[model samples]
Target: MIKRITDSSAASPGALCRLLWESMLELLYPSNIYCICCDNLIDDSRPYSLCDDCLTNLHWANERTCRCCGKILKEGYRWDICTDCSSASHSFEKGFACTEYGGAEKNMLLRFKFKEKAYYGEKLAEIMFDRIQPEELDVDLILPVPMHKRKEKRRGYNQAAILAYHLSRYMKIPFRKNILLRSRETMPMKGLGAVERRANIENAFTVSRGWDTIIKNKKILLVDDIYTTGSTADACADVLLAAGALRVYVLVFAAGANRTV
Candidate 1:
């Protein structure tokens, strides 16, 4: 089978020009490697973009995590279901999270979203897709949680949508971006309780009209940058379910920590 290039950013005109320049550089110099995070020189033989130091420092979601949401459990906690998942009802069937939301991981995500370190998304997507096999999810389509038009206009990109696009191409699953629409903008859900978060995001999303036929009975993988209380995911999934999606699965870059505070 032929391999399709999965860096969706490269599809855009600006990105295409950059890719051409990089191609020319590679041809002329023959060898140069840069770290995905620090821009430090790296060995050309490395398969991933991250340098060894950065790779060693990056945190992976490798704890004894919850079955439903993938949140890391506190030590000596034997239950598979996390506190949040146990008490709440999530519209999605399951979730796969890639890293803890703390320290270097948290800093990197903040940079990815707030600082517009856009290329970081490609590395995050590569990690997420590697950890959770798309074929295993059996999803017919990949849908990134949508952003409100106003916010997206200022931001110039929806970070989650970037991840979803790359995932769709790498996994060879169809991606329909506009099918799931964010009807309104929401305040940041940070520091809110689960109930408040759910309320804050309620009715924030809707499935686009005339797309019901395409989504009906199809399995969908909902993509996002982070999973906090899952309020955003639930709101999005609820609409998809209402539109007759068979089930929705979630994949995220990181999960909010289950702190003891």
Candidate 2:
């Protein structure tokens, strides 16, 4: 008949400690943090928010590469420029990339573009941030490949713009998305031959009116998601140079296997 003392009840010190511990966790981080690539639970200390395996699988463009286009050179190759770069007339002074455009890298880019995975740009930009030395490029401003109004509306966001924004923050350079405009949205360039790619993007871009003076005589870095045949970068570079930009350099997250000199 004596009243029992329930020491393990909600009011007990052990229960209170667990509650406080959970509350502190809630205060420290989001309820559901996961890796951006594989959706695995990210370790508390992993700043990249991507699993280590995915990070390891990222194909860094770390071979003897073309100085102009950054494509992997054949073994025993001695030329500073690869065959593709030596043959092509690239408008940009130089182009750089963090990874080759295939395998896991290709899949990630495809998702970032068409699968509403825009946040993937964060990791891509981080990778490129280490590869690009903005001071050496001496870029006055950063510009992203613009999307046409209708296309941007349909896509919800421009992947290139997201990358340029992160790149700007890393390099402490100003970013301008509107300076260079995509005059019109053309058909998708996927599977297009090199010549077709060039034709597809030719004259597809122009500098916005009145803003040309700002970039005139000032170096510019053009940002994009991928560098395929260099046609897109070249096209954008041509427009910037035409607008009097002192020099236009290109930076991309991935470099395609097909390189045109």
Candidate 3:
């Protein structure tokens, strides 16, 4: 009896091509790939890791912004200042935010924080770097605003740390993770007035003992994902300044369009 043999190549060209393509993909990209915005399969050629539709929907802060804080400012507004900054005094010598907290930008931030899409940090950092003026940013260290130990353990990562790591790489600054510690975990600052938020975060942070020597008379760039009332950043800056940091500047990915106090 003669047995019929199947030639794998002759069986199906499409199947063979698919297998080769899949192998190439495995070698080229991450296994669990998905769109950053819509959780759909990402196209191999898209510039962003987001699907086309979601990428189109992304609203960049493509307008003029406050030089001090990166908040979107209307056309004809005075240069270097926004209404909010004009009225308020910020502890951070200066700040930079990439986008306003609305539309796709807001969604991306939410995903980054609560959904573990930590890779977004790189993209956000890129945007931030573009907005920052290199001549104005001479810093000795990149310090991330710390999350409390309990919260850090629960999340398994701090978003600010991720942002700081990327910013450090982009800016060539030393990234220090343990220099600042969140000594307390206060209630969420959302919905609270600016004064309340400041009060809540006051005394919530402390610089680690050895950090005093390292940061003494050194310029620092504090990295955070958001700047709401500036409470968290202020608290961190206060500790760093008190510990002898020469100057403290903040870099955030987003900030409220309208700020009070």
Candidate 4:
């Protein structure tokens, strides 16, 4: 989670450094000057800093999404839930995603996560903010899927927290970064099967000790950059629910295509 700043003039040293870095990024990659997806020039009128071609090509998950996981289902499939959700249970009450994890989304999200393009989070979150409005979700608080301290320090930022921060600002919901934490780092989920992923992520999250009162009986929106097997979200949701959260809903920028079989 990004550190909270009570005041700009008296920011903590870490906050001050992030502020300076953001300022530099603003000058170098100002919004409305370049498209976030295809890098073509775009005007402010284009939403989310996307060019017309990229916007047209972007795979919006506007149809046939799995009811449980919110991943785009295969065309003409006669199922309400995806294959993964049908085969296993998830802790999250529901899930929402803005786009399908297609080629364009994969490229853009890779840049946002691995490249020094933190500003891309703003555009992605703006799109997610739009997605949330239609759902009419009434979450009491927003939190990000946490990263282990060592890994976060190595990466310089947590992509999920960046998305959650922008979402909190757009939705006016209170955002808490330190509540749910990644207690340990596990092997990267890439190339792992669903069972392996779940085992890898199990018991990897824990809630802060003193946040029970605030979490009790409250609805939570769990923010993340992507949703794959739902292992990561399920682990975090299990911890949050154990800490007394009423319901945990997941919101992501992109989701993997639903399995047909």
Give the top-scoring candidate (lDDT).
4
Those runs of model 2 whose alpha carbons end farther than 4 Å from true positions after fitting are 1-32, 74-78, 258-261
Query: Model 1 misses residue 221 by how many Å?
Result: 0.2
Please say which candidate is ahead in TM-score: 2 or 3: 2
lDDT pick, better of 1 and 2: 1
Write down the lDDT of every candidate, Cα atoms only: 0.77, 0.75, 0.72, 0.84
Candidate 3 vs. truth: CA RMSD? 11.8
Highest TM-score model number: 4
Error of 3 at 89 (Å): 1.0
Q: Model 4 RMSD to the real structure? A: 3.6
Which has the better TM-score: candidate 1, or candidate 2?
A: 1
Estimate TM-scores for all models.
0.85, 0.82, 0.80, 0.92
Q: How would you encode candidate 4's per-residue C-alpha lDDT over 1-261 as one tens digit per residue?
A: 122222232122344566567666666666567888878998878888899899988899888888998998877888889999998999999999999988999989988878756667777888999998889988999999998878777666777887888888889998888899899989999899998999999899999889888899999999999999999999999989988999999999999888765
- What are the C-alpha RMSDs, in order, of all predicted structures? 3.9, 12.8, 11.8, 3.6
Compared to the true structure, candidate 4 yields what TM-score? 0.92
The residue ranges of model 1 lying beyond 4 angstroms of the native Cα positions read 1-32
Q: Where is model 4 more than 4 Å wrong at Cα?
A: 1-19
- Model 2: how far residue 123 lies from native, Å: 2.3
Worst 10 residues of 1 by lDDT: 1-10
Model 2 CA RMSD to the hidden true structure, in angstroms: 12.8
